[model samples]
Target: MKPVLLFLVSTAWTLTGAQYYYQGLMDYLENRLLAIEDRMQFWHEQSHRYHTELKDFKKLTTEAMDALSKEHSLLFKDLEGASVRVDRVEREMDYVESQTSPRACANKADKVVEQGAWGLEESRGEEEEEKDWEEVQSKVSDCVEILSGIRSVKILKRVGSPKGMWTRDPRSSKVYVFNGTSGDSIYQFNSVRDFSSSLGVSSSREIRLPSEFSGTGSSVYNGYLYYIQQEDETDVQVVRFDLMTGMVTDIAMFPVESHALVYSLNPETVADLAADNEGLWLLYAASDNEPNIHLAKMDPDTLDIEQIWDTRCPRENAEAAFVVCGTVYVVYNTRLASRSRVQCLFDVNDMIVSEEAPLLYFPRRYGAHASLKYNPEEKQLYGWDDGYQIIYRLTMKRKLLV
Candidate 1:
């Protein structure tokens, strides 16, 4: 009986131990499952945030593209308006060319002769005859002469920028050299002889200007420096600066089409300031579409416009131009730099006929002229070609006018 009771006790103890082991394994699995569910819930929230950010970025990109499209539309409209203006200018130019034909000029000359004969019969006084003689002499002095040819070319010195201007004042012995298209300083030499030699910067006097110049179109006259000042992108102002006082004496705003360059070859020249026997002149293209150059007579002292003339000289291949007396001689060259020639001219005094105009060609030189400044007293053209300062001596003859 004792042996059977011991066996029953052993069997019950083994069963109790197996049941406790199974309960512990079940509790561990429940805790692991809870941790996994928490991780999945966090991942879902992060995915929602990423989706919202992507949508915001897409909205911003669309807004930027819309703004860019609007700007492009406005730019296209401006281009179209400019095109229309160009077409209108072309039509007006055609009409003017028809009127200035050779036949029309001949008819106008016949009427002028009849008027002159009628006036001769009515006039009878000595004073009137003296006045008539003086008038004839005055007219002859004002560009009744045309350029026969270029007599000689003297290369003074090679200095400064490859494209710059160096000239002597017609009224004085002072030589002024500008290094670039725009600058506030000017190199002044006492005489032409001094400029020809390599004196360096120490010997030359530097004149500091109050305002900066915009283009290569600057000239010295009667101890004053005249230059173009770009007030804005479109508006232009001519400033007359006194060399002695180093002050801006005068500023005159002139109408110029800055959209197109004055000289296509030398774009740095917005408006060329030229001096001749008749006084100061401004050469520029007024209309954006009109490639023809326009000439304006300006008062040296007051910077006032005396008169304006459309030279009808094409600006396509023109490099530089100079005024002799009252006639404009436009020098032209190829884009690759060839022998420059005076292909077109305009006489403000109406003394030169198209048929009688001389086609003067220049001797082959370094390159195109950056600027051609005429010295009335010396009767020479001070030109800046490539980097060489050159002087062109001109031979003149009486113009055969209608």
Candidate 2:
């Protein structure tokens, strides 16, 4: 009985120790759970504060945007008001200027009358030029009639300038060619008022040119003189003369079709023509063809069939086009209206295209078969209008600057 009671007491002691250990572990776990809940509550408070601040920030940003929009609207209104005031001031100034000036319109009218008187003088000049043309035409007609038998007079390039009026030989290279009559008689520009003094024509032996080879068309380059030659044959052809050897060489044989006359100041198209310095260039067309730009280049000396270059001619640009100082000046006309379409400046070397500038005004109606010349010495461009036979000496100006 005593040994059994001792064994029961030992078992009771072991069960009490296990119960104590389990109770301590449960108390520790409950404390840890409370600490975790406290940390979670703190985080929730912080998160709520951040969300409220974010909402307030968004509201402020929207308000600021609204204010900025209003400010922009006000600025735009101010600018509009300023522009209106400026326009009003300009109008008032213009009115005052007109009132104070010697009526510019009246002055312009007087100038037109004065110009009318000048036109009378020009009319007389034209009369004289007409006589000269008759003589030229007679000679040209003679040549053409003779040339028709040779190759059929198909193409013609008329080369002449106002300077021809003062030439000593009317039948000289640029205007006339005849049978080498007498040396002095053959060189016939002496018909002009100042022929004797100009050529110093003394005797028939002084042969400046052969009588058989004088015409109104002349080209000089590379230390040689070139003139148009039509032999006594039925074909009217153009030929080049060697001033050194006194020999004639044939050049172009134009197409044998009836086409409108086209003229060009581009040395390239003329083949014999040349632009000595950087200056204005011109291209003239006389026929009624769908306008487009055309370009050509040739060696002035050899004239070895000049190759074509790039051109600014629009699809409807006039049938003729030319360049000056590397800038392209074109006459664009289709039916009746024509305007000067000068293109941007281009480099002759690199062929680089740059900014473009329109001249004077919107393109204006102009005469076809017009002649343009630039005197670098005068910095002026001279044009001859064949329609009414007028001369226009134009200088570059800041146009339409009202």
Candidate 3:
């Protein structure tokens, strides 16, 4: 009976130990499964975040590439423009070099001193002739006589509607007549000589402007047309027109006060534009004040006005103006039957008018509506009369203002 009791107690203890071991195994298994599930969820969230970041990076890359393309195109265009300017400068320098060559036999030795060796009789005759010429010049205060007269008259047949300022290109000698109403209405001489001869020989080419483009004062530089455009009477801006591409660009804007103060009364006013060796010039003529007219010289590239001067115009209205050899010549209506209109020269250095008046004056046919233009290449002045259909080629007779 003692042996039986001991065996039974031992079996009971062993069974209890086995039950605790099984319980601990089950708890370990459950904890490991929960940890594996949490890890899988963390991996899924990380993948989604990486995908979102990749999408944002791709979008930003595309935008940056687009900006770079635009920058490259602009840089290329600028380089091309620089090349064109350099070529033009080279051509100008070559022309100057060619023109500066000295002429042969231009300077002559004094014949009076060498006459004894050659022959005294021949020298005496030449001296008497020179004295006679000198006497005539002295009587006139050494006034240099310039032959002034109309060289030719031609009717500009191709001009559809000539209403505003006219100018001649210094390089090409092509005449451009502006029509403010339409760009298609702009007239250009196919051959200036043919058009000047009234032959109607060669047809003109039309420069079509955009519908929104409008201007009054016009000039050409390096094959580009420049003009002042007035949006309103008080709003003015400078525009550049490309002759080859028919592209119009706004370069600069004038002060509102400049427009408002000028041409206070006249609603339909004209602006004068002229160019010479000295650069570009602009004339603001119509004003109610004492010194009504204002003249300005503009920098070609910057559009900055370098000089400004005031003039009390002697005539009723200023039609055309040009700067040449450091002098400003103005054409205006004189309103006299004997002399309907006149061209007056003003010394730019001395902006002073002599009491004698009209430093150099010449009469013109009274065209009720006429315009004047000067061609530095031809050294000729062109006068166009819309009323009589007459365009006059005039040569100036100039004398020093005594």
Best by lDDT: 1
How well does each candidate superpose onto the true structure, as a TM-score?
0.66, 0.33, 0.51
* Candidate 3: tens digits of C-alpha lDDT, residues 277-341: 56677766444443455677777667787877664453345544555544565555434322333
Return the TM-score for candidate 1, rounded to 2 decimals.
0.66
Ranking by lDDT: 1, 3, 2
Q: Is candidate 1 or candidate 2 better by lDDT?
A: 1
lDDT of 1 at 188: 91
**How much lDDT does candidate 2 score?**
0.36
Clashing pairs in 1: none
Tell how far residue 394 is off in model 2, in angstroms.
Answer: 6.3
Instruction: TM-score winner between 2 and 3, please give it.
Output: 3
Number of backbone collisions per candidate:
0, 24, 0
Give the number of the best model, judged by TM-score: 1
Worst 10 residues of 1 by lDDT: 103-112
